[model samples]
Target: MKRITLPLTDEQISTLKAGDSVLLSGTMITGRDAAHKRLFELIQNGEKLPVDIKDETIYYVGPAPAKPGYAVGPAGPTSSYRMDKYAPALLDMGLKGMVGKGRRSDEVIDAIVRNHAVYFCAIGGAAALIAKSIKKTEPICYEDLGTESVRRYYVEDFPCIVAIDCEGNNIYMSASDISAPI
Candidate 1:
């Protein structure tokens, strides 16, 4: 499987197409409902966000606490559409990727096309299985945000799909039509 880091450049996005299987490694930030809400407010006010998003990929998750020596607890993807409103704004800031389940609004999809970003989705509720791939986790900021807080994960070969490409194409939204679950 191919491995990539975030802030996917035009070259990377251009090379990626639907059905491309990848394992994302590097710093992936976790944010769900609570964090997404806070991020929206930060964007509207032109305030500095808790983390630098230059080329960051946000993971929509709230993992369980890690066991001793484990990088993180059960890690799983959450409903991605929840952050639809905030996604467009962040995309404007050079955020090139998002990971979650479910379809977001057309506005979010349009913003993605306009900004040349893609969406990656992880297997939902498969936290323990997913956590096996994480090598480390560190609280970068937003410590008090609870599990909804933003944390950085250094994952090794975390399985993923290029659900949405720069061309404004998506799979999960139409997975029911094109492909059956593997």
Candidate 2:
């Protein structure tokens, strides 16, 4: 497994390849559809975003409320396609990486390549297991969105697979390219 530091540098991102298993450490922000829409709108209106995304990673998640002695609860990736509409803009804004589950749109994949970004896939249904990696969770913006609110998480050895590398090689596409009939 490759160990990656967060806010990935250009060299680090370039070195990653689709299908690489990675253990990431450092700060990653969480956001799902609601938060993405709000951020997209803000960008559309030429307003400053609540957080600077340059060199930062955004995890597409909406975690359950923490139980006692936990940093977060049931933290898992949401479907990446739902955020595809807004992802390009975020990439354009210097967002370096994204973490989520499932396939992404062609446009979104293209944007990732153009922006020199990487897309990771967190295991679905591994929520409780994943939360153990989180060391800190703090609200950052859009508190009214409740569970969908944006938050910053400090993580240690958070597990992921490189679903789409900076060069635009996509694991999902490889799966789709399989010609054998099941």
Tens-digit per-residue lDDT, 1-182, candidate 2: 99999879999998999999999999999899999999999999999999888889999998888888877889999999999999999999999999999999999999999999999999998999999999998989999999999899999999999999999998885465788887
RMSD (CA, angstroms), candidate 1:
3.4
The global C-alpha lDDT for each of the candidates, from Candidate 1 onward, is 0.83, 0.94
TM-score of 1: 0.90
Residue 91: error of model 1 in Å? 0.7
Q: List the residue pairs that clash in candidate 2.
A: none
Estimate TM-scores for all models: 0.90, 0.96
| Model 1 ranges off by over 4 Å | 173-182
